[model samples]
Target: MAVGRNGRFSGLLVVAGLLAGSWTGFGQEKKSEKVVVAGTPAAAPVPAAPADSVTDGSVTVGGQVIAYRAVAGTLTVGATATQDATIGFDGKTLPDAQVNSPDKDKPEDAPATARIFYTAYFKKDAAAEHRPVTFLYNGGPGSATMWLHMGSFGPKRVAIPDAEHQEGAPYAIVSNESSLLDVTDLVFIDAPGTGFSRIYGKDKEKAFWGTDQDAHAFERFIRRFLSKYDRWNSPKYLFGESYGTPRSAVLSADLQNVDLNGIILLSQILSFDNSVDGPKWNPGVDQAYALALPTYAATAFYHHKLPTQPAALEPFLAEVEQWALGEYMTALLQGSELPEAKRQEIATKLHGYTGLPVAYLLRANLRVAGGVFSKQLQTDEDTTTGRLDSRFKGPDLDPLSGDAEYDPQSQAISSAYTAAINDYMRKQLKYGEQQTYLPGAYSDPSFSWDLRHQAPGGPSATEQEGGTNVMPDLADTMKANPRMKVMLAGGYYDLATPYFEGKFEMHHLQIPQKLQSNISYHYYEAGHMVYVNEAVLKQFHADVAAFIKSTESGK
Candidate 1:
């Protein structure tokens, strides 16, 4: 899915956008609360509450019972040091900053601040310096980390169909046998304005709602977390999904004071130009189409839509990947100059791999956009193939439309995740009893995102003029910390950020060739959210655990 100028998915939340109507389920009272606007009299300061709620929990992973202490809380951060120094970790204003002033009465006079929420699991009795800690989050740019919290490596997970629509409520929320608690302490964070996190003061949106600003907010949060928990010496790792992958890339570079042990990326898209969702808008960027072709073939093969079903998926995709980068890319580059015979030949090949009609392929000029492909792939059955996971299908909202209006995968499983996190946080973790847990911030009309990014060395004039790309930030981090390992994981059925696109970006990183060996790749037979499949979840858990253990030894 494309991350629009607003930093939200046009079709889905790079993670998965919540359905608009689901907002009512969170609570109606919060809807009445207003954002304190600049130039207005500041509202009476709310009474200070406990900074966090503490709970104890245990989960059985790989037949071993693990006990943990869960802390659900919010950490206040400011746009700058002056703003941050105003509030203490206890949510109380500092003594030096406490003063009655005429100008302070105005909301704009105070600096912008955000109370970033998080749920952290620390293994009981583990040595802080010896045990590894991994920070996990999902990406919408506007999305909360609830998906990773409720559906992936969390101590518990909401049980839904592996690749089908989940039936209504009474959904099973169960202990996750695949939980990563066995190998690392996990911290799942809600981005500012999502879940229990809240931003306030003057121009709060501009302060925290952009590519560069968001990474800085996370950097501050991580630094504050390490200090609060006194785990500064622990092996630290970052695990981010979808848009979070790009956030990790920038954040890894920003946190230069600390040398991170590793970064784990799922459903990655480091370069916005490589996304298939809106490549049509940027002419001459043919890499997106070529990189996405392998995923198209995988999806077609899964649905039995391909002209010839390959006996093995891995080998078939290998063949398609080779052709996509070679013959197919060459044809697309030729554009208007390509001979009719060559264009026809390419369309024929696309038909065999994508299962779309030859005429439709020809009409599209052999460069099918992600949404159009999702709509056309299963149009014969009057269904829309999923953009997040092509293994999922839902009735088309508009069969006659040029592209899919909604993602079938998002629609199929969003409710289960939303409900699971709400219930678990309140009833189990004992947090957010009075506040609304926002799955996304897009519901707020004031929510806006700045796409401009400052790379490692400095702000690039070229980046300011084009789509945001954090490949330099990641490459710089890897080169500076050569021992810092990176793992890229994705699903073959993921069209949102095609699995092959991750490989393409990693291969092209600006780092030295010798440093390339520090990166690893893993692919699943599932979709964007690979852990949605129980079978794949098992392998996902093992792979991640092994990676952490291998690096944690500090050899």
Candidate 2:
């Protein structure tokens, strides 16, 4: 099931909205402590995190710059290369998490942690001999990589049922059939202050918090990982959901500076402020209109099934985009004084476009919250309101007119997955630690959502800059490594990072049209985690397997 992503908790948006640090999965918190360095590094001063210095493209030496020192070392798989699975993040070295019973008699005091420890899952039975290795993470800006890690794709998945709100046993997670692992090696990196990752005092904190700083940190992390893994030449891909989607977009260019292949965005959110577009006085008022359009149509298609074939949605959306960007944009700009003629016209079109009544659009003045349509679209006469997520509706005692009965979608999305993450951490992970996974309020006020808007024309000299667009750099990588193939994935109903906005960047980025065929993007019907739909999962895995096998693009 997908999250009721639109019915955002405006307050929680502020937390992730500000830090831009490590927002993957649900959320993450890391303990930040600096380490003293000793010994010398075998390499030269890295102007940036050089990709070839360490194995796996990552390093954990104590000192920085030319004074490179080994604070951490490698622990190659002890197995007979029989398709490695388990991994451990023990400081000073990496280790295999092989265990006999798994349930230890008494778990030792958790080791003193350093370096936000993370693990990777390289699926066995290699589906592709020369498969592309994908790096996946979720979006919390404060989240740990665990969400997408164990919960979704990782080798050892979180224990949860496939459907929402399953009873008997808290959750049961298994190998994700939709996981790209069948064709790719997946690495989950914990961002600073979340998971085992942490801040090294205030100095390090400053660098990992803001937009630019966060990008640089991720850039450095990727470089170090490539070096540590010794896969600098391998075909590399990155995937992220929600906030992680924007992180992947920014990192696409950031990693290109150091050299990376291509990028994939899942439920993307390109700009913090733009996601909620509107006049300065009432932010997001305009964007709210656009965001509500797609899902409304999706619901309409779901309920009415007008055109018969689901594929028929494309023509309708093509028209919705035209109206939203054109007339809808124009009307929202017109405050109370919409000439009677234009009002009637817009109201009628709104009714036809979104299966909602023209009276509602007229009363709302073309500005309606996503929640309103989600419930109103399917509300019954006896039941005045339905759940916020039209996806989930149940009969209720209390009846309401304006507000939704409840946030069924949010609760459903949280039910199975949240329980699974906790189980996966304990059982499969063998981390004996027993702690409940806290799925933050769908709209917790504590989460950061407030940040200064980007300048009209991107960043200026006076303003700070970190992770912005570096699509051109990725283009350069393709130019250098013509052998590599790449893919990009987008979600159609994603209000956070509208697929249309992402496609616009290629126009802004300077790229030779001939080389463009190497990177191809495929869209899905689901909201963010397209894999949630078993049908989509079947197709997504097949496509990823084909791409990793070097058959994609006729290459």
Candidate 3:
């Protein structure tokens, strides 16, 4: 989800378009957005609330909301440590390390000087010889890192509702059965303004948010965290979701520059443009539709709408690649010069390739937005439900309206999985009693974000043409760090990071074949956060375990 889009209720998040928004859940009309930083929109941002006075306010950490103290902060990146495998950072999610620990008095008056606080999860086991210590964080420029901390990673988690759809479910969140703690000693960091993490008040708005500042502050946090724990020599790894991908990626480079170890990119955003591009910036949706085609057909087949094809998603996408690149791209490039018959032919081909109706394709002027795909592909029953997964359908869609069909839930499976983590932190982790899970802060579910228009250039050109470009840097980073390994995980149904677009983005990456092998790609039947899909996640975990193992050391 882009930045803070998690704030809204996810309808069908397992599926891509099942949820209401795109990129960062801005929803349909805004498909033209340029995702410069994971799902975070560079141009359209969720305005930050005016900074409150940095008083002695406290939020739940270990338990009660005690007093808080403001201080000047310093963050620095440290060099990679070389050591014996005996120093095991516990695989446990650090218990609330908030400022008000029982050991010291909670600073009543804001501190006069700058101070930094660190929280850690510890495991008492002695087999510390060599371990993969992973630092985990979730997306959302404004989100607390708790999603991953409590969800699939932290040794402990939140207790979430069984079904998010169940009416009036107490903000149920719970301990996750699938935490990375089994293999990794995990650490979760809260960005400046969210969660229990706070910044200096006065002229102290500096450490709280945005890309550069965050990377800088987080670098400091890593330094503090490593020094505080004294495990500077452990083999380190980073795992992040949504915006955290960028955070992880940039930090991968940052840490490596300072001699850090490898990085694990979960739901990668190689470049902001590649990640956030809507229709204009990205036509990956069509390819996404293609990758999603068989799944759509299969889901329909399972739902008994389309032909029960024996073919699977891969072969279907293989055919789609041949056509999309040959016919679709050709058609798009033809513009007005293309003849009427060719347009109809392209539309017909697109319908078959995409499971969209030929008439809808033609009527859409040969272009169908992700929203249209969500709403149109349903069976003609007045009971037609559009899918957020876009690959999956729902019970009913407001046919009369021209917006997202199922929302990202029925579409976005991850929303539920990730949301559950929030509850997990409170209930299971037995921590953050005072803090609430800020799902997708920085997002306004009710606020209307205008869909952007074509900027008339290949990609938006910023001052240095540097804003929102991560893929190029990814390419450059790979060049700089020859041993680094990269993996791109995409869901066939993901409209956010369509399977084909991801492939296409990689196709255009400025890297060589040897370096390319350093990068790998995988696909699932789910959407962006395919990790939420039970079946897909099982496989994804297995695959990820293998990938991480290979990168860390030969098994």
Candidate 4:
């Protein structure tokens, strides 16, 4: 999930809208000519055929030259099987087109369709069955996969400051020595209505902009991709970051016919209730605060804000984690019934760990929210700590305000990413020459997210009144596919989805104790976008490569 310009958590909450006739040569028409027919309704527009631009490139990874074929393309997907049957891999309408197109004025008309965009890199002359293919995407629910494509595991990466705000460019786009191509083929996909992906047809927003609906779209896209590329026998894996983590859980469970080899989650948040963003709204649920404390302590330790400086970070964090889940949580649960002396004692400890004033902690009732912490952590210097990466700081937009106004980390490197993707897609990849790339889909005011979800073996269309939790989905997937492996990676400095929250959710999954062995965890010293740190990125590549090699068939 991404922190928006307004400092509100976006990614999951933000939705998207149709670009409404954007591309010229594509299936979307600029304007539909009105045709009046007697006793007949307008036929649903046929989706454009799949468009692809193939290019060959080579990158040196792990000190070996890897020649790869890159395909930048779009594949159309329907809202349902009936609509899907109308289109084929060759982009021709099937004989059953009339059966799929419903009356335009009918309430039961099909929802909007999407032409999902993706850039895939295949190892030259590799056997499909032997090569593991990993589908990678960034989560903004509304965000494009540009971050992962341009900043992380792709063949080329955008170079920016690790923890400082990058100044205006001529930003360098360099060969990624750590690209995952050495171990697995990579496909980076942009969500519908983001990047070159577009959605159109009836009730577009409601059709593709919800939890279940979005998962379904991705499911269709993956299936279609496998069929088109003849990779059904390949050992497949899903690599999702941020909001994409929950998407992976749901999608993994839904794709029961396909036995995935593994799932790699970066900066995960399977349970939204564990979010530290604005836990104050939910009052009695104190886990968010407790889960976030370790990250707060890590940030304080990094910034040298701790009252008594700890000699080492990891050991200090271990102590903080123990206190947070033990004494700190017990004190919070007491809530107004606790004696003033105990409250003072807890507040003092919080200050020592977080470097916030004891008076501030007392004023906050010891339940400081993530935004408030970001605002108050560096208040003495009039700086606002980044919610995504606390290591990055910026001048406070509102010094007197209780919450941070914007994310400094996002502002710091967004330009370099945007510039790099635009240049690279056009110049290197030879796609999107005539279209504009949308980094995210928050610009449209018509966008609205649907939080209702139907978990496996649960009632259908249940609104998550207490916030959406997909821990059950992951657990059910593991139970169904007992051999499937899972990898969890996160940054200690990420307050957006604290590293501890991922651990907490994974520990609480309803799977058997034996299945717990299928899961592995890795932590980095960086923030939400851990690859921003070159050192962490190198280690991340190694861990992921090793995980894939261990899990893939015939490895």
Question: How many backbone clashes does every candidate have?
Answer: 1, 63, 75, 2
Ranking by TM-score: 1, 4, 3, 2
TM-score of every candidate relative to the true structure: 0.92, 0.66, 0.69, 0.91
RMSD of 2: 12.4
Model 4 poorest ten-residue lDDT run: 19-28
- For residues 1-555, what per-residue lDDT tens digits would candidate 4 score against the true structure? 343655333332221211111111101112233355697665456445446999999999989999999999988887776676677643445676776455646623555678889999999988866699999998877789999999889999999978898679899999999999999999999998888888776777777877788898899899999999899999999999988998999999988699999999999988777878757656788899999999999999999999999999999999999998999999999999989999999999999999999998999999998889999999999999987889999999889999877778777888788899999999999998668898876555445556667899787765334567788999999999999999999999998889998998999999999999999999999998889999999999999999999999723
lDDT of each: 0.83, 0.48, 0.48, 0.83
Tens-digit per-residue lDDT, 1-555, candidate 3: 333122343321111121122334434233343334576522222122222212122223223232223121122221112110112122111354333222123222221111222234544352444666666676555555544554454444444332133343344443344544445455666665455444432222322344444554566567556665565766666666666766665565555444434565555554444332234335433333333333344334333444334356577567666776676766767667879999999888765655567777787767655555555656465333333244444455465765444453433234544555545444433444454444443443322221111121234322233224355545666677777677777666555445565566677777887777776877877655565454565576666666667766522
What ranges in model 1 sit over 4 Å off?
1-50, 91-93, 96-102, 460-463
Q: What value of lDDT does candidate 4 attain over all alpha carbons?
A: 0.83
Better candidate number, 1 or 4, judged by TM-score: 1
Predicted candidate 1 versus true structure: per-residue lDDT over 1-555, tens digit per residue: 223332333333342211111111110111333476778655444335445899999999989999999999988887775556676765456788964432545655556778889999999988866689999988777788888898899999999988888679988999999999999999999998898888876778889987778888898889889989898999999999988999999999989778999999999998888888777767888889999999999999999999889999999999999999999999999989999999999999999999999999989988998888889998999998988899999898777998877777777787788889999998998887678988888777666556677887766623455677899999999988989999999999998889999999999999899999899899999999999999999999999999998898654
